[model samples]
Target: MLIAPWFTITVLAGIMIAALLAIQRSGQSRYDSLVTELEQTRVALAQTKATCEERSEKKELEITVINASLNREIAERMQTEAHAKKLRKQFELILNSAGEGILGLDTDGNFIFVNTAAALMVGYEPTELIGRSHHELIHHSKPDGSPLHTGECLIQQAYRDGVVHSSSTDVFWTKDGASFPVEYVSTPITENGDIRGAVVVFRDLSAFEP
Candidate 1:
């Protein structure tokens, strides 16, 4: 009986060892399958990363183009403003430096602009003449001390015809209601065929009072 019991115990132990080995093999097979799936997942992730990088590159290129276009537009605007400033300065200089007295009037027969020489010739402060009518200030009279209403006043002619060549007039009025002889070259100011004002340049010739 003792030998038979020992033999049964030995067979049971061998069967248990065989079952453990089979379970270990199955576990190893499952681990191999898992490793293969993980590798496939890694490859898919790499492809996704590459696609994202390409899209990022495209976005960067578009941003670069937009920045360059904005910079060019800003540069052009700055250049235009600088050019306008230079032209305004030039006009001021030319008007002030002229030898002849220059007067600029608005379309409504009001004084709008003038140079330093013009004020000196008219014997009034330059600011006083602004917003004042030219006709009320500068009507011509004859040399015989009478109010001279000659042909057409230069200022009115300039406003009407929108142009004036050289016309020599020999009479004008002063601030103190004194009559004098003068010569004038007058014209209208225009831009694009639109009249902005009248301009008249005059010089007193009464000094030759022969």
Candidate 2:
């Protein structure tokens, strides 16, 4: 019951050819799958790149807007400062032109400003009086060498009570410790319904007194 040698050879050759065909088909299938996967990956990468570019553009735009806003704020602040400086200079000139001695005080009785006439009358430079206590400089004592009480001083009361105080008998001292009679008016400076400080207008009575 042994098969013929030629038939056996033919059958074995056919099996070998079938196996080779199956392997080739499987390899081709795998190659097609890999190609599809690679195409998908490329598409995903392109989408990611587009999204990143869009976000980058938005960030750049935001930065540009912020810089523009900051620049505008700086410019406005500088302009306001310049205008304020100009106004201050004009105010100073007006005060310096007055004939009467003019003195400005802060809430704490410190000298904020003194015009040229005021400084000369007090025998001091304007720079010497600024920021100094007004009460301590020329009005600390009476002509009789007694210490003047803060509660009774008309000058102090002007700012404390937010009222106008005047006196013709009060005496003011010079830098060299000489005293002279003065007719003076002390007026409170009110702004926004609040008393901020005081302004003193005074004239030396030494020239007018007999």
lDDT per model, in order?
0.59, 0.69
TM-scores of all candidate predictions against the true structure: 0.52, 0.65
Residues 115-157, candidate 1, lDDT per residue (tens digit)?
6766776777878888997767766455576664534566667
Instruction: Give a tens-digit lDDT track for model 2, residues 36-136.
Output: 65555555555565669776565556545655655565565566556555655666676677666777776788887687888888899988998898888
- Ten residues in sequence with the least summed lDDT for candidate 2: 1-10
- Please report the candidate that would top lDDT against the real structure: 2
Candidate 1 residues lying further than 4 Å off, grouped into runs, are 1-90, 140-151, 207-210
**Residues forming the 10-long window of minimal summed lDDT in candidate 1:** 1-10
Q: With candidate 2 superimposed using the best TM-score fit, by how many Å does residue 209's alpha carbon deviate from the native?
A: 2.2
